[model samples]
Target: MAWVALIIAGLVETVYAAALERSATFTRLWPTLVFLAGVSVSMLGLAIAVRTIPIGTAYAVWVGIGAVGTAIYGIAVLDEPATAARLGCLLLIIAGVAGLKLLH
Candidate 1:
């Protein structure tokens, strides 16, 4: 259950991250609201998850998920560069997250 919350929180991190960009530094009303809501929910979920998971491991996993998800979103939706090196780095982050889960 805690792990589930952690994963959800990580996913929400991506939402807020992308929305922050769309918010134009919070100049846009709707996207700013979305970013604020996402930040609250994501932090709540992270707090719940940290009750069970180790802080360091949980934080790393959460960040790893957010980073990869945001990068993918940038490439797919924001017309960001999708170079081989970037893709490889993303894969490495995925691998590290997987390794953490497996080791846990």
Candidate 2:
């Protein structure tokens, strides 16, 4: 389904972000490869999902998912700060993403 594709794409976006950071400006080998693959799959999924989902809604959801997911990745694995404010903002984004889905 389009929704499934979209969710996969969104999750892939998180992988893409993490791999990119690990790529070290593309100087690395495996991480750069992973980044490339993640981006390709993510884009394909987004393109497929757009066929059935409204572009505006789909885009917002995709970005929201990516943002929240990547932030969590950064906090959990990358030793980034997990301040209360940052966590709160992530929850807000999650709420907005859920609202968009529920309204759809």
**RMSD in angstroms, all models?**
0.6, 0.7
Instruction: Give the alpha-carbon lDDT of every model.
Output: 0.94, 0.94
Relative to the true structure, candidate 1 reaches a TM of 0.97
Evaluate candidate 1 by giving its C-alpha RMSD to the native, one decimal.
0.6
Estimated TM-score per prediction?
0.97, 0.96
The reply for model 1, stretches above 4 Å from the true place, is none
**Model 2: CA > 4 A from native:** none
Instruction: List, residue by residue over 8-83, the lDDT tens digit for candidate 2.
Output: 9999999999999999999999999999999999999999999998988898889899999999999899899999
Give lDDT tens digits, candidate 1, residues 1-104.
98999899999999999999999988999999999999999999889989998988899899999999999999999999999999999999999999998888
